[model samples]
Target: MTTQSIKVTIKRGPDGQGAFDVPAHDNQTVLDVVSWVQQNADPTLSYRFACRVGMCGSCAMMVNGVPRWTCRTHISKVIKDGAVTIAPLRNLPVIKDLVVDMDPFFDKWVEAEGVHHGSLTRHDPIAPVDETSATRVEANAGIECINCSVCYAACDTVAGNPDYLGPAALQRAWTLLNDAKDEGRGAILDAVSGSGGCHNCHSIGSCTTYCPNDLDPMSAIAGLKRETTKSFFRRGR
Candidate 1:
């Protein structure tokens, strides 16, 4: 029996597509294929991976036109016609072959006030929190996000508007908004209600659809919209 081979197409910076042939293996991951190409075929190829397990979320990329965790994505699951297309995450500047600039993705966190702001100081004791509280429930929903940027790359709003605070950032802000210990909800709400904030999201739900961690960023964004609108009305009262 003849061993089968697979063709992989990678998107290179400004230049174009780069194709490579690799031997096929059972239960091979997309990351495994990319690593093989880099080690055997092209040594100049550049990409990023840390944990190789899905926990780190650093190895996410576009596989066959959808942003996914390459380390966890099996070739058998995504192979099309004995081929696969690997590309950098979308909605960010490409730095080199299969590498993208993450500065902008993180900057949106500042825009959305995603940072935690608590009134308690180190001198102060940790406040007792009720795990079953509604606010805690809301915060827990989005707390598992690993700053993967996959949801941001998959978001259509981020693709169209450069200033739009992407899904990860806004989802983070929503969680902080509900955090009982956070003292910045008012200011965060103000930021999220601004021009490129939660109101700009069209609720297309692409962010929710593509999140590898199964988070519903669309729901979080909607909560921000409702709360912000209510805050706006209360100020006028």
Candidate 2:
């Protein structure tokens, strides 16, 4: 049997870059390539992955200059010229090879008030919500985000404006805003209405284009814009 090989180049921060020739197999994923390089070629290689099945976005990286979940990206789909390049996600500080500091991305999540502030406590009764309601539908649209930072890495707004809250955080805000049991609507609006808020988005649609889960953050940002406008008028400011 003949062995098939592929060239894999990885950007190693502070240690320069490394390239390896690895055996390739059919139905292989980008994460598989990375893992092969780490195990067989270079044990020093550092990366992140969990639930290689793709539910967890921890394996997200830059594959051919695009942010993607390595676990979900098939090598056959992204291989170019019999080679592939892997790098840490962009729009965030690189912690090491193929690893980025996620603090900024998550800090903006807090800034966007992504957490659910419940209107009721354990002592209170469960709130009945109509599943078919417009608010519920809108909220459910963006509630599946796993905070993998793929969308944030793909966002041009965050690349230009360091203070800009990226798509994931803003999308979470949009989800929480429509939650009938949430009591932080006003706070969420205030967070996304500032200088580094959703208005700063250029509507490049990169977030939606790169989302691994197919979530439409562009629409969420647009909803924030409309709601903020209404909020402004309500404040009479």
Candidate 3:
């Protein structure tokens, strides 16, 4: 219900000190302001978004130095002094303007073996698993991840060491590790073990602090440390 014009400033490129000044409404989200500028003020301004309603992970950016979903971020809360600074999400290669290269962010998922791998035979009798089972409940917590990379972008671990697989991807691996159907749980754990893997997570939890979806990636990383340690005893049969 605010009726004032919002002062919005956007950092146009990687290491860009210059900013694009734009006029925005108090009620408008940061995403709305950026779109308006692209449509009316600067046609060449580059950014990325899809499903502006907040379901798609494409619209994440740095709103006043915090990685967040621009579509859902309100100007009022972000701009305490009536001024806003928009920039590309942190810990990634800035391609141009507000757009960033997402390849490295996604590559970590593969590194952690985030994909599900099960060897269930459809011809065999179906196993009746309780809907309220503990494993299922634990997996449910991580199932809502939208892969926005905000957690990865906010993580100091990822920022310091580029090879680190990151919290989001590691969290995905943790979900699979507890799955009864996942035959690759052992391999997934193997992939995520060691220094550059789960052990390197300092548990500073910047990922959980900045995750827009309210996920606790820090706990997931802890799970990896526990499970991988247990597996060490069983190694080599």
TM-score of 1: 0.98
Error of 3 at 28 (Å): 0.8
lDDT of 2: 0.92
Residue pairs clashing, model 3: none
Which of the two candidates, 1 or 3, achieves a greater TM-score against the reference? Answer: 1
TM-score of 2: 0.97
All models: lDDT? 0.93, 0.92, 0.84
- Per-model TM-score versus the true fold: 0.98, 0.97, 0.92
Descending-lDDT candidate ranking:
1, 2, 3
Overlapping backbone residue pairs in candidate 3 total 0
How well is each residue in 89-108 modelled by candidate 1, as lDDT tens digits? 99999999889999999999
Order of all candidates by TM-score, from best down to worst? 1, 2, 3
Q: Backbone clashes per model, in order? A: 0, 0, 0
Q: Compute the lDDT of residue 149 as modeled in candidate 2.
A: 96
